[model samples]
Target: MDYVDTFITVAEDCAAQTGVVPKPRGGRDTVAVLQHRMISAAPYRLTQGDVLFSTWLLQQGVDPATVPPEDPRRAEFFAVDRACLRASPLPKTHGWGLHFDAEGRVALVAVDDPRYADLHDSAGKVVKAMRSSRAR
Candidate 1:
């Protein structure tokens, strides 16, 4: 499933004052790093499903060459409910927001960016990213 005309705001507990680029750790790219790479490089080029699936594939070390876009594997992968962008670390901890266009394409918006407010106000729906920690 994808969010259309929606904006996912940063988590309430997010500490970063502005969007911070995620960095790889332990000589490997973390999920946050992988997600950041994808969305940052091609804003509005992919849907929430595409980003999640692609990241999952990468994490599983699945070769894209072997799994074409039309491959049944894609359908199988999405058969179960998966976490949405509101659960993404970009918004949860990295001070970034996720904006889903009318076509359901997604792009990152820094929390401090003027467009963050613009999109939040103008989007058809708004959802806050999942909190990073349990509420006190």
Candidate 2:
């Protein structure tokens, strides 16, 4: 119920000026998909790095099955040091919030969801996604 650390949480109503949409394809929102993959994969869950790689692949309309480790394009995805999930459109452009487990894996929590309120008050450390509009 107390607070110290902070992260940005841009609600859906606030996104129009920036032109960021929750789910550009009109299906599952990006953060939700990330959460689903992380949860289902469990012991093999993706680190933030993997999620960033996969998210971009999905956005590009690639066939997921076609991407193997040896694929030439795989290198292109990792060229960046890491994908800052905190700055991802999923949370900044969508209502989703992010929480990291002890192992540093991520799962999404919606800003309006009850769990968001709980975590916001939790002793555990959690951060809202950052916004492009503001400097950190």
Q: Which candidate is the best by lDDT?
A: 1
Total clashing pairs in model 2: 0
Q: Estimate each model's TM-score.
A: 0.94, 0.57
Q: Please write out the lDDT profile of model 1 over residues 51-81, one tens digit for every residue.
A: 9988999899985547778988789989998
Residue range 20-134, candidate 2, lDDT tens digits: 3343255654654553454345522455655666666776876555788577666766765654766666566656565655555655555666766776787265555666575
lDDT of 1: 0.91
Ten-residue region with minimum lDDT total, candidate 1: 62-71
Itemize residue pairs with steric clashes in candidate 1: none
Candidate lDDT (C-alpha), each: 0.91, 0.55
lDDT of 1 at 100: 90
Best candidate according to TM-score: 1
